[model samples]
Target: HLVLILCMFLYINSVLLFTLRSKSVFCETSRYILLYNLLFADTVYLISSSLLYLLAAFRIKLTFYMCSVVILPPVLVYSVSPLTLTVMSLERFVAICYPLRHAVIITIRSTGVAITLVWLSSSLNIIIRVLMLLCSNTEFSFDLQMKDFCSEEALFRVPMYYYFVTAYSGIVFLSAGVTIICSYIGVTLVARSASTNKASARKASQTLLLHLFQLGLILISTFHSNIITAAATIMERSHVLRLHSLSFIFLNILPRCLSTFIYGFRDQTIRPFLIQHLCCQLK
Candidate 1:
């Protein structure tokens, strides 16, 4: 709990400092707007997870309403984050591939709309997920206690919806994964093929690599735990607990923490200010 709290504090302050220092530059650009939203989403996820961990550690019982309101929504909304990454990657692809027409193609308003749509679809998907679980329970005449199963694994165990939810979610994951991979792959190819600007091509490859690294981390962190938690016999309690702890730190915390820095430093617009802030703090 203390660790999570410290992380949240650092993450929030870092974002606040960055945002406040670059308000004009950040608020003016569509790419920055999407990045800001992504960061905010991560911030919310961190806070909610921290509170949930704190409560669990204290053995506090969260009511169905409380879990639904506090826990599930944030987790569900967090699913939108990878989708947001895909959008950002697409933005980069357009910029790299269609450099001459990038500005005209991806305007500020269109980017906002894209981000908004991602959130909307994510919410609907989550809603369907919850409803499916509830409907399945009702159909099977099983007790539907939303509060009982706070974990994703428990949610999947809910009878009738199990297969459908798994299938649907798998499809959603695959779609987003494909989109991100494809976009970055295209950017990498375009960058490599350009003979004139070797430096730009190298930079593009670097960016794609970062995107792929983050994507792989997110997928493993998000889905790998589910498999681990499901296979009860594979890991002993202590081992599972240790793995969970490590996952919480590396998968949940480190990736998000690194992403904010990557987004801030990767964009040339913000690099100068970020460097200035870092040097000032070092002094």
Candidate 2:
């Protein structure tokens, strides 16, 4: 059932991505381009995390280096969602608050640069985490087989990695949260202005709110593992495992799935094309 759900969402995400590139308009629009990047990262994250889940379910233990290679991409890519959301929120804010300058401020070139920076910053953070993980174990070796299930929790057991993850998540989410909230407030204020186009302002305001909701989902997904660990203290092992699986579906998989429908259905320009592509109507 879990595998089925993952595959379903993966197919949907792939279709949405193709729909985005099917037209020049989607490619040129800054928001659609950002959405493409967000969906792509989420797709990659889903694949990696699902692989780890399946492996753990099958009781397959990987060596330290192997697990690191498989899991590290997820760590790097998961942060991309919130950062991209922050960028998207700012883009909306500029569009609403500075209509005249928005085109100049948010060009195709700048959007590409922003996406590049998000990936670079995430990569740098992952590199630091990897280094800390290595240094935490003086006896660490590439060939050491993991006795425990291979998950982020297992790999992040060292105090240094744990502390670094905690701190990194705090800083990233706090900054992203602040940016989104400010953008929401700015858009709301603009929406009230008689000078602004009521329809467009209202739409942008709603989009910003959805972005905030998406950010909340991502934050919850990131912390779900920790929540599961804490619950294990008082719960039976079977109950803990069940809760873990449920959490993975609701927290991790569902949020990534929502991005497609949220943006796909909401935008008129993309809706028809998205539906056509989704229905496999190549004509």
Compare the candidates by TM-score and give the number of the best one.
2
Note the Cα lDDT for every prediction shown.
Answer: 0.67, 0.89
Clashing pairs in 1: none
TM-score of candidate 2 against the unseen true structure? 0.95
TM-score of each: 0.81, 0.95
Candidate 2: pairs in clash: none
Which ranges in model 2 have alpha carbons more than 4 Å from their true place?
none
Tens-place lDDT per residue, model 2, 131-152, is 7777877888869899898888
Per-residue lDDT of 18-48 in model 1, one digit per residue for the tens?
7534668678777787777777777777667
Model 2 has an lDDT value of 0.89
Which regions of candidate 1 deviate over 4 angstroms?
Answer: 1-21, 137-149, 153-157, 193-196, 224-236, 275-283
